[model samples]
Target: MKKTSKKNNNFKIPGTELNSSDAERGKKESQSNFVELLPLEVTSKIFSQLDIQSLCRASRTCTSWNHAIRNNDSLWKSHCLTIRAVCQREIDDDVKSGYTWRVILLRNYQKSKVKYEWLSGRYSNIRSPVSLPEKAMCPMDADTWGEILDAELEREVEKLQ
Candidate 1:
């Protein structure tokens, strides 16, 4: 007696054996957006951990991801709060004026960074505009200029003493 090995053909075309409704359902299931699979809180938690640039990139990847990121204010709030460390007055003013956290962030994010650099005296020694670092400088409000001036004055006073 000769023994023969049986081969299993596991590769099957999708919807081959299902009815029309079942095939449609299967297609929907297979094409379901991953962002929609998770609960809102779960997706928010996952997205909140991403850095600002990564979050923006993720939001642009697809409509579902943009919806998830855009609709959740908490993610933008947390990031805006971090920027508040450098731009407290601006952030507070915007918040008081009823600007959403995302809008506040969009308005202040780069300004805060530039303001921090100025406040931190990163540009204190520039002899002229030509000597300044090659970077994008956002327009700062008068109050921010005052703060930077104050920091510079304090440094000068310390030097004089």
Candidate 2:
């Protein structure tokens, strides 16, 4: 007796079964590999999995992704502020509560008041005591950065001593 060819059977795709109601749902589900295609929330979860360097590099990959990461200013504001430690200083109380960063930037960089106002006012919410270097300020190199860290550590150790 000859066996029938399996291809002759009008059969359901073994793993492609759809319990979805609408054709659109079925089509979307079938075309989208649930295993591969993440939902937006899941995509964000995957993004958060990346290290800081990976995240920054990924942002430059394309326009849409870049927009997403860059627009999330609040997420990186703290990091930017902390790394900007050397630029920090306390402003005169008489000037204003949160003008420290601007004041330090202008003073350390010797920027004009007009340019200072232009640059500082661009940030939506800035530091109270000022953080982050001004545009004119030359960024500290790794050696200088290390020295600053060492000085800070020495001060901290001395305080505990």
Candidate 3:
């Protein structure tokens, strides 16, 4: 009886084998190139040019990028300020909480989006505040609610005419 080694049965691809030293060298060569090559200031400047969404995507690409993006509070602060232009009250409340710039933006991003929708009259026939998502209701006060309702009413009236 002949015993066949399980290792010998494994399939090997042609020309794909690398010795341990060669594999290590390949790993070194293929190591993430961007952050390693660019100066920190240059990398930060490049990241700063990205919009919020692009910055977020870039941050997820690697650990170095994540560190760069998260550590740079000014990047998040700038985005929060831009958002503030459209949703001042929400941003103000977030800023007052004394969270980091990243947290401030995270906390208010959705609220700002919802508030913009309300202000822009994106939803019609909002007979009650319950029609809105719970997160949307919290940042808004009675006056903002009234404004949304008034805008919705105006939209409905315009449709009738």
Identify the candidate with maximal lDDT.
1
Q: What is the per-residue lDDT of model 3 for residues 64-161, given as tens digits with 9 covering 90 to 100?
A: 88988898888899999987976776678767878888988888777667767876766564666678567455465675567666877787788999
Error of 1 at 37 (Å): 1.6
Candidate 3 at residue 69, lDDT?
Answer: 89
Candidate 2 C-alpha lDDT tens digits along 53-77: 6767877877767766555544344
- In model 3, residue pairs whose N, Cα or C atoms come closer than 3 Å (at least 3 residues apart or on different chains), thus clashing, are none
Q: Which regions of candidate 3 deviate over 4 angstroms?
A: 1-31, 128-161
In terms of lDDT, the poorest run of 10 residues in model 1 is 2-11
At residue 59, candidate 2 shows an lDDT of 74
Candidate 2 lDDT (Cα, 0 to 1) = 0.46
Collision pairs in model 2: 101-130
Q: CA lDDT of each candidate? A: 0.84, 0.46, 0.75
What are the TM-scores, per candidate, against the unseen true structure? 0.78, 0.32, 0.62
